[model samples]
Target chain A: MSAINGQSTNGSTAAPGTPRTGGEVVCDAMLAAGVDVIFGMPGGASLPFYDSLYHYQDRIRHVLIRHEQAAGFAANGYARATGKVGVATSTSGPGATNMVTCMANDIMDSVGVVYITGQVARPAIGSDAFQEADVTGISIPITKHSYLVMDVDDLPRVMSEAFHLASTGRPGPVHVDIPKDVFLETTTETAPDQVNLRGYRPSKVGNARMVRKAAEVINAAERPIIMAGHGIDISGAADELMQLATRGSIPVVSTLHGVGTFPETHPLSFGMLGMHGLAYANFSMRQTDCIIGLGTRFDDRAVGKEDEFGPGAKVVHIDIDPAEIGKVLETDVPIVGDLKLTLQKLLPLIESRDRTPWLDQMNGWRRDHPSLKIPDSPDSVLPQEVVRAIYDISGGEARVIADVGQNQMWASQHFWYERPRMFFSAGGLGPMGYALPAAMGVKLADEKQDVWCVTGDGGLLINIQEFNTLAAEGINVKVAVLNNAHLGMIRQWQEFFYEGRYMGAFLDNPDFAKVAQAFGLHGVGTSSRDEMHEAIAMAHEYDGPVVLDLHVDRVENVYPMIVPGTGVNSVIEDPR
Target chain B: MNGTETHTLVATVADHPGVLTRVASLFRRRGFNIASLAVGHSEEPGYSRMTIAVEGSAEEVKQCEKQLYKLVEVVSVRNLTGAPAVTRELAMIKVRVTSNERPGLAEITDIFRGEIVDVSKTSMIVQMTGAQSKIDRFLDVITEYPIEEISRTGVIAIARDDVGPRNGRARG
Candidate 1:
């Protein structure tokens, strides 16, 4: 039989009436590989793949994004929120190029997303043909693995491998670049259900000997602390981590992305630890005798100027990735394994102890550097006040998706999360414009779930276009915009570091409410404390997408600030 | 070559279409120059060994080792620069020749274990395979006359297991 799928056919008959082109096989394989949704945009090179999606609409839901970047971010968000592998699709050239940042960010945060992009046909690949690009070269540095499928026969194997590499071991983004002809050609090969990658084995269970040693250290030290990270949520070890933390009288300090891994409302919680961390949390880290780092890479932002971050503390670092074992802080005992499995074995060996003195000392720091209170400023509303209002309105029931910059720090510093996977953000890459689409993706997981996107004007503008996606899909995600009339974080840095030279630090004013309204969302703008409260309440009661613009103080900086180049303990509290 | 000497890197990698590109891309990404590289089959089936001569500082080489190990298909890696080893490269030199120079050329070829594979009235092709230094010396002698062209396979080496960490042990 002859075919007209932009290439000569080989008469592949995968099913009745289906000629079984590579594109159809890819879509079929994805469905078989357990993909339920795909975020993508249509383009010339990706026509074949898009056409294949038409036949599988009942099996797969494709979220059409306005921009390819948002598609990738949405896929990443979906993967992070739900523990399933997410897929993003785009055409060749600029469409693929747009996904670079999301790919880079996903790898940094260890987000598992498989990106499928169309490529120029094989014959015209290097001729600088229209919509052509070197997608493999562009994605190699950012992706865990990338492929350029030159032949149609390699599609099934490549698809299987891409999904496997993306969702296995240290999970991150993987890319597959398929030529237009390959997607148009017919193939009969099947994607394998089992993978046999000898060189890619990741040690998932901790060494029993190291777990024993870690237990001994925890038992001997009177002021041992558990610093948990996002890996706890990824590996579904929150329950096990809580068990270990409760088994010992250990205080738990959460890394930024690990906000809800352990309930912030728990008694043993020391809140978050890091640069802009709670002052008491940083103090607990400084005063601790032993730091048991669980599933964290010990990023610089998480533990500023490591020399004093955990002074006089012996660190027992546990992680699944071997490369992250001693990549940063000096670890006395390294246990490399899945956090769930490691803690499961280690919990039994730990002995309970009373550490009243350590808890008392941490309480004293809390009294000294108290959590932010809504300031009595009549002229400008404090950003924390907005977070407090959102907390009250949501009753701590919504999953908060905080954007980078000032809004992220404010949400982390003020809002409370009571369950695991309740907070998601671009913690490692700190990308702006993440919260809006990420919140949309999170909402897609459960349509009835309350999801909030807390972003500043600077970040919200970066992905303001995503409002269309929210409105089009009828996703009722609540948005809170902290409008400061400046790039708040950079302005704060300039205020502290550059002798107040605010060049390129100011953001021209935009009524975010108006922009949101233009995108078919209910918009509310407020300046006073009472108005902010009413606006948040209105947003909560709204039936669809609601954008609340809170005009906040432009000069206010996130406090408990660790001055750059200063020790982590040398934090600057607000003017007392 | 950042003012550093060349060092040989021996790696056992999976034999496939994308494996070579991965190794090459890694070297490029890590900011190192592969002065010479020869990849061929290894003793183990479904795997290949690569002998790459790279130029970088000791610290850079250490970083490159970690980066290379991160590649999924890379099995083992060894730095055999200072270790006791044998290195070889094969070269075919087509040189302009005269009947008068035949005796001298024959004597030089004998010393270098070379053979005159192809000869014509005006030119001759001498095939020589030996240590890199030996090939350099032979080329120096041949270049004294008008040379037509020279083709060479990059240097490939195997470490003498008697020298260091034996029994299949390699540093990461």
Candidate 2:
């Protein structure tokens, strides 16, 4: 009904009298939405979209990843690093299915990512054509929203809505599946200037009365702890979090994803709190009288044995999503709004108080339960020592993207993060093989920022093909493989809970450093404490992508672990 | 039936493809049991209204309401569990009867204000529309005879009087 490709009414710039294909319209919509980069791998079903991408290379940079899974993770990492909406595209069937895990991962971690999948032709959608899959139905429970566009005219609006839903509210993944025919169909549809969804509206401002009630609860309590979560970093509320903690004199403990939100180096900042979290942090949670949960979901990992966690403590929960307010823990004051805005409304009402006795008691616990100490070994290298070596070699300046399992725990424990967005991990879904590809995304987000991918022997092999991507793209991300020749976390659990059977946990492995060199990148291998520091330093100083495989003690276990179905008070420390 | 109260919820959602699947999938994934659900076009253009009866405790039902709102296609959801509302269901019963039994069946159908829609040598179809309890009672009374087939529509409900909009628009 609108003019046909004239001076664009939407933000897209299309020359007058020029015809546009559906693929070009989709690309133009992304441009109008301010997406400068996309991580994707094209296939037969998405060839038309890739063809359009070829022409827009100057405006939109496309990173061709090795696998669709890496594309999804790279997009997720891009979103987490820059707080922008990340975009990934793949073909139908296996390519789209490969992205399911990452979509689940993004939803669990509350990262904003838009996944575009190409479907079969419209007529073949349900006929079981080659490469045809019901991706929209499969992603219904995982994605915040999804669309299968049959009509070419709806492409622009669907693209705009997908980006809007992915980047707003709780910030999760949104999927868009386009038939191959629609990508080649000719259309003059223009992207909308704004989204017009009647059912979708995200709440941003906190209720004034609820803020006052929370302030009252915090002021009257003697020992109050601020349980900060990933929402702090997602909403950019780190400064406000610091203000509230300092003003109220509350000890701040972080969830795994909330690692750097409150600056672990700060005096009031206790370390990460979870199953593998520090003992002092968990002890503070147990002893506190009032718990102020800020931008967190009170996950089962963070709040072990919910009924027993923070017993007799009055709780105040603030989050953007209303469902998360009372989902797990009961709250005395529940404020549903954006975290930064809610904290702004709360800071003025908070009465400045110094609980010297509470701070002194927490300091006493920290002294008595010293964790994260790297054991001195003359001939053997410990995993904790490798983490500490990276931190020392990089001078605590690199952004550490850690993979799952024991290596993730050691990295979180040993690395001291002083700024927000410095520590990234698969906290919620706990997906393995996330570090390398996600590091590619983080480095691409800001080429000058030093990025490190800390993974284990088992996790690295999952996405080892990504090493070629790094070398080809010339992304200088340092890789540290804490090679213990086993799935350390699984083996630890097997030993602790399964009578040390070690079924399927041992990894008969390859030389990872040589694997890196074969991919045309620098490689170094170290097996002793003496070679650990030098290998890490070499990787850090290398101008190109480099891998440092540090062989550590095979049987070392992560300490301060709270056994499953138990409370933080029952944390098990290293007996020695 | 297990002594847990059933909460009736009315939701207005966009009339789009896969909307029903989204709503049903959410209930199943969230571990909520759906006792009954009926959906049809609403008075508003491009929107559909759904009446869902869910079996859960008061807390679980409240969570169900919150979770349903999380779906982007769902415009609004109202829990009409204890609200003043009118509920009804429709049922068609086909009973096997001989010529001798027709009179007795007709007399009973008249008392319940039901109509015999069709009749053959061996069977008679009776159509009944009323509250769920009345329909249940009718089925109970007719089960003594040889019944060939039965079909019943799930419950559909709306707020009574001017309590709320039938199309689920929020009151200004």
Candidate 3:
């Protein structure tokens, strides 16, 4: 067959009228690879991939999101929900640049996602080809691996490799950049084989000696606390975490990103630690003799200054990434591997010992903080009250996807999640519009579970376009938008640190309820605490997407603020 | 050629774009000119790597390896100094020379058992394969002439078929 453009589009015999080209092969390969949906916003370079999507309409669903950035988040949600590889497609330049944040989110959270973007034709490559950006180069820091497929023959292999890499080990996003010509080229090579990445391999288990050392510390310690992080959930090690916690009778104090690793209702579980963390959880961590740190990056927020974060505690950090061991607080022992596997091994070696004094102390702190109390401030609805309602209705057992800002803080402090990984939030990136799409990812990851996308009004507006993606894909995700007219979290910071300099913070948003209705999903508006429970219950029962626009106190702050640089003692204690 | 040493390293990364740049930057910034470095596809598409290499010496390379792991993308690092291992490097050298320099090139090539890939009126590009020493020796001899450009395939090696890194021993 002759090469045309670079795709193998000419050799296949066409019926009397139907013309088969290189585009068809790619579409066929994409279908064969089990890609049902692709989220993207199109442009000139990606016309060929779009052309292929046109050919395979029913087989592959292409969702045209409002922005390319949202496309990446939507795909991430799809991947998180389905356990299948999430795929996002976009054209070059800004379309590709918009994907960086989402890609970084996947890298940080370890979500399996495959990103495809069209590059300018090979001939136009280095000339700063119109709309041509070095996507492969730009994404290297955030992807597992990336490929710039210059030749059409390399597409199948590159794509196969991209998907393979994205789905394995610590699942993450990978990019495959195809030039315009390559997307349209004709090729002679057969369908590409699953390229074996010879150098890539993830160690399934931790070093035995390290695991044994971790166990020794835990077993010997008079009071051991398990500080869980996002790694535990990303690795699907929740079961192992629970097993270890149960077997060892160890108490757990989770970081904000670490919530949902263990059920909040569990007797030993103290939800979230830090400035805003429950007084009991922070106190528990401070007093513990040994800290079994798993899957949690001891970000400064989790542990105020390294010295006082967990003072007097010997931290045995068990993380997949070894550098995190002593990067902050010195680690007495470091176990590197899948959190579940390491915990599974250490579970057997640990001895059950009750830390009655420690538990009593933690209980006392819990009593002191007593969670947040939502005072009726004028007509402003409290976000904390809504979370308590959801917990009351669902018993806090279902999965909760808390969007950024006050909604995230409220969900983190209020919603009681018993399992890890279920509480998905944009922790490292702290992207404002992360919750809804991530909630969609979480819901799709486990459909049977009740998934609530707890978001704020400002953040919800950023990716509200994905409501179309969610509705069209038939994903049952519940969205609770804490409709405070301002960007709650940033507003809080501005109120405290920046001296109330709003500056693009307060967001005048659309009627989110109507927006949901427009997308053919259920939409509800809540202004009172009494009505919040019934609304959440109604939304949860609906078999499709639903949005609850909650009117919350515009100035309500996530309290117990720990001024940065100051140790734990500097925490603002006035509840007023 | 001067005496050479080898060191192994491991790093944990955020598994994002430009991580390779961060990895490559370590060598460039530290001024530990990397003789060769190769990154393999990772098992957890976005995790860490047991990156093994041989450069500098036991002490210098070890120090460099530790710093490499400290880079932001780098999660952690370890140097297998006295551990069982294997090492290899791939290089493609295109040397420049006149007709008169052919014999010297050939004589030197013959000593190293190298192959001539291309021959032109002014220069002949010789391809050599071996440890860092063999390639270094060929380049050192050819440096006397107008050396146009040199392209080297960075080093990629697995421990000599024995114990598989650190994880293998744990299974036994």
Candidate 4:
């Protein structure tokens, strides 16, 4: 099959003069859109779609996940990792509702995904039929666009539009809800050759005047820093970002999602910035004269106490979404265009300058602060060390997907990502139990790449049922459960903000290794630092899935923290 | 008008299902309060024009405009806040009035260029069409009598002459 405009041409499933089922039309559409895999589960409403899947299994590989939420996260993980439109599906009502959190996560993180949900029959849609839910209505706020297909003939166009909208500028999740009967209805329609949405044209080229203004700002700045964000990865502008940074001798600070866009090993890299970010990186915000915010929204987490953040710095905000510019902070030069194109235009005009004094100043701060220290403890292993050990063993090559909360911070802080899409986490929504299932998608996306799921005891248990799926599918993803036996982040907050009154922060965790073993996967439990490295190695060596549960210190908190509602200047380093 | 806390914005959008909900939801989610919103079919066959009066700072309203443009159904948005735009509202007030008091009420309606659309033995319904402020004044003048109910089709607006249609193009 030849490819044109990134879509495969082998889209027709029905022979000439033969009618095609709506489900087959959907299959043809997916093939046309170049969808090679889908993460989903079967249900009553989606039986016909599954029946069609049975026929098209040769072209599209379907992974039957344990839960709809896992299916959505897995699809999201696939999208984040590959920069393609990941697909997930489910039946009506409960199945559709289960995917809402993942949709929210995808939207928040700007991930491109297409969620195909089966609905009640068209006639029974408004009658409150059994297993029916208003999927499109529920998804309106969370998705980039949503459609409730009433006509079976519109399937091809809707599928094409869904993929187009999902993967376009400022990528986000697009949903298509189809009636159960519609999927079974016969049609001769084929996938559309083009998608024409009059109201949905995204800007690609930067305005020449604004790009010039931004270039002028960059050229004039004596001490400037590049705040690279998820947009860099989304637009595939990492090379452009590096060129701009290197040309101007500018320091680079990454938002959590922006990690790995610029190689952390580079001297210009200042590491992740925000709450739970590097102290030196957060501190650098105060002294910088210009903030070249590329593809970042300057989220509240990234810019703490917005009014007090970068009080004197001139902000040059460049984003594909016009709404994101000047939405959070006042931007001096707001460039609304694709980051890659805008940077290309801005680079040549940016005059080269040596910022040795600024670099030396940040280096001094890095020396003094020195975050990511592994505490020495004989009785319990530190989760930070576990992440460090994974980075060391994998040689910083594994795609590390971290579950939310304390474990997420530990992974972001310790593991140095050298390439884009190497580190995946629930950055915007902060959903727990994302790693295990997301890792499944990442590993499936690229079988040669080693994948690791670093999760906390609290987060791991949320989607622990996926161990059965892993065992059944034989996905070789290594898992590291940081078992603190508490909702570590909540506990840390309770100790600091709530005056030590722990309310529902403690958890009596089960033996995760035993749980994995019961699911027919390799499992190992390690409580001491001595056993941690060997256990990680054992999990890495296992051909199939393996869960290595590391019992870390119960009270250890992620530090270099900015107190909630505080500014970047007021950073609280590890007291110990 | 540019400095005013409340601004009026006009958006041209596709006349598609749930588009109104999407627009209303964007306002609610973005924390921008909508003072009034009037939507109807535009000169274009399949598109609708929405006149939205929102309350916020200039920057906040600008952000609201940008967010509205983010909607796939919304083709374009024009902030008619400081522009020379023709704006009007239609209001119907059903008031409790005696046969004797009806004469005075009729006079008040006539003074405001409004008409008594309906009249009963002890009640009268006045239909008024004008600027929001004119309708507010008419309501205040009629408040001397016992009030019954009020129905308002919120403000709808369009740019005046010489200001070309900034309807379809997205502003940076």
Q: Pick the candidate with the highest DockQ.
A: 2
* Per-residue lDDT of model 4, residues A369-409, tens digit only: 99877666666677888999999998899999999998998
Instruction: Summarize candidate 2's per-residue lDDT along A340-385 as a digit string, tens digits.
Output: 9889999999999999899999999899998777666766888888
TM-score of each: 0.87, 0.95, 0.75, 0.96
Span of ten consecutive residues with least summed lDDT in model 3 chain A? A1-10
Complex DockQ per candidate? 0.33, 0.78, 0.07, 0.75
After superposition, candidate 2 runs with Cα above 4 Å error: A1-11, A15-18, B1-3, B162-172
Candidate 2: residue pairs that collide: none
What's the candidate order when arranged by decreasing TM-score? 4, 2, 1, 3
Residue pairs with colliding backbones in model 4 are: none
Interface RMSD of each: 2.0, 0.7, 7.2, 0.6
Off by over 4 Å in 4: A1-18, B1-4, B163-172
RMSD of 2: 3.8
True contacts kept of each: 0.24, 0.79, 0.03, 0.76
Off by over 4 Å in 1: A1-19, B1-9, B16-21, B24-38, B43-46, B52-63, B78-172
Shift in Å, residue A309, candidate 2: 0.8
lDDT of residue A120 for candidate 1: 86
Q: Which regions of candidate 3 fall more than 4 Å away from where they truly are?
A: A1-35, A54-59, A186-195, A376-378, A395-398, A442-450, A467-476, A499-504, A514-526, A531-534, A541-544, A573-576, B1-22, B25-172
Candidate 4 chain A, run of 10 with poorest lDDT: A1-10
Q: What is the DockQ of candidate 3?
A: 0.07
Alpha carbon lDDT of each predicted model: 0.84, 0.89, 0.73, 0.89
